[model samples]
Target: MKLAVIGAGAVGSSVVELASDHGHSVTAFADSSSAVIDSAGVDTAAVLDRKRTDGVVGGGAPEDALSAEYDVLVEATPTTLGDAEPGFGHIQAALERDRHAVLANKGPVAERYADVRALERESEGSVLFEATVGGAMPILSTIDDFDPSHITAVRGVLNGTANFILSRMATEGLDYEHVLAEAQDLGVAEADPTFDVDGTDAALKGVIIANVLSDDETEYTLDDAEVTGIQEISGSALELARADGRTVRLIAEVVEGSVRVGPRLVPDNAPLAVSGTRNIAQLETEHAGQLNISGRGAGGPETASAVLADIGRL
Candidate 1:
């Protein structure tokens, strides 16, 4: 597959590495201020090195990438609310060209599902975004196997950063701030932890899942989901829950029309009790009963693995 990549962040650099590993070529890529679009092949290593040393991906502008020829456009830009723009526009440009889109960006999928589906309906290209929700875990694809009517409920430990903090507070009796700092130092959480800790990330994933299941009938957006994060969860609170063999986890759920994310208590030994940066997603189907998948949910390389899978499937 020939890919035009956007972002050039951890997810983008990892995509460059795994694309080579999977025998694909990245024809174009863009960072914040610059871009490089080539028909033959973009120098993946050079782009990555430039991003590392100079803080820019290439010499050209992002518009150059949008116009480049490629089999697929891999959109992995940072998440945003409202129109989900830049990423949304990038994907739209690709669809207009009849190029397939393998997305790692959550904004376009979560905030503008109806518009996205409309583009793919008339265009020659199709869109797939498995990496946006579960990293490499295939949560979106697995849920697609069953009929939406049969799939009654969906739930998961969706945010690894929040889960890590909550897990540490429960096990080590450490306060929220302390563990969050530790997570930041270890690169488990971003320097600005607002999105992960404040439930926006998980809620965005929930909206995506709901849209996928309903086929955009719900028109679910970021505002539709009810969100609550683990930011205020303290060590003392976990201590009280620990006395009852319970732990707090930032759980995301979609059942009926409700999409929700917040702290939930479950047994410490439960499958949902996964620790560290691991994640688990569950699907409830009337015929299939319940199916679960658990694995590492974060990290650039792991997510890029998922992006490669989507590109191959396309």
Candidate 2:
């Protein structure tokens, strides 16, 4: 497949590199500042080098990559709230041109799902967002392929940073502040940890999953979800849970027309209690019983793997 990747960040650049190695052509790709366009396929190595050393991915503005030759446009930019611009716009451009759009950004699906669906209805192209919910867990794909339907609920440990922090705090009896700082130092959490700690990230993913599992008549958005982050969780709280053979994890759930992201108490042996940046997604389906999928939920290569898989499916 010919590819145009927006965002030269971790997931975007990983798409470029993996696409090249896997025999797909990356025709155009952009960073926050610029883009590199080529009809015959961009030089993935040179573009990655430029992005790493100089902080610019290409010569033109981010929008220029839209016009470059491509079949699948991978939108891997950071998700922004409210409008979800640039990423949303890039997906529109791709679909308007009858190109397939595979998104790793959750904002477009979680925030403006109806508009995105409307665009898909009008355009020749379609959108797939498996990476939006689970970094590489095949969540959407499994849901799509299920024949005997009726998914009562979907729940999981969706955010790796929050999970990592909570897991460390529980196991080591370390305070929240110490574990969060350690997570930052380990590159598990960003310098500004608000999004991960405040539950925005998990909430966004839960909303996207709910959107995916919802019917056309039932519209769901981020506004419909209730969110609670792991910011207030303390070492003492973990100790209490531990004494009872329970662990606290930031669980995201979509059930009974309600979407919620919050810290939940679960048995230590439960699938959702998988520790340290790993993710687990459980589907309560009638026929398949409880389907659980687990994998590394974050990182450049992991998400890029999901993005590339979506492109291949396209």
User: All predictions: root-mean-square deviation over Cα?
Assistant: 1.2, 1.2
- The stretch of ten residues in a row with the least summed lDDT in candidate 1 is 141-150
Model 1: which residue pairs collide?
Answer: none
Best candidate, lDDT-wise? 1
TM-score of each: 0.97, 0.97
Shift of residue 90 alpha carbon in model 1, Å: 0.3
Question: Can you write out model 1's per-residue Cα lDDT over 101-145, one digit (the tens) per residue?
Answer: 988999999999999999999899999999999788988888776
In each prediction, how many residue pairs overlap at the backbone (N, C-alpha, C within less than 3 A)?
A: 0, 0
Candidate 1: C-alpha RMSD to true structure equals: 1.2
Which segments of candidate 2 are over 4 A away from where they belong?
147-149
Per-residue alpha-carbon lDDT of candidate 2 for residues 1-314, written as tens digits (9 for 90 to 100): 89989887889888998997777999898888798898998888998998888999878877788888889989999998878887899889988998899999988898888888989988899899988877988988888888314787899999999999999999999999999999999999999999899998989988887777784556677789899999999898999999999999999998987999999999999999999999999999977689999999988999999988888787
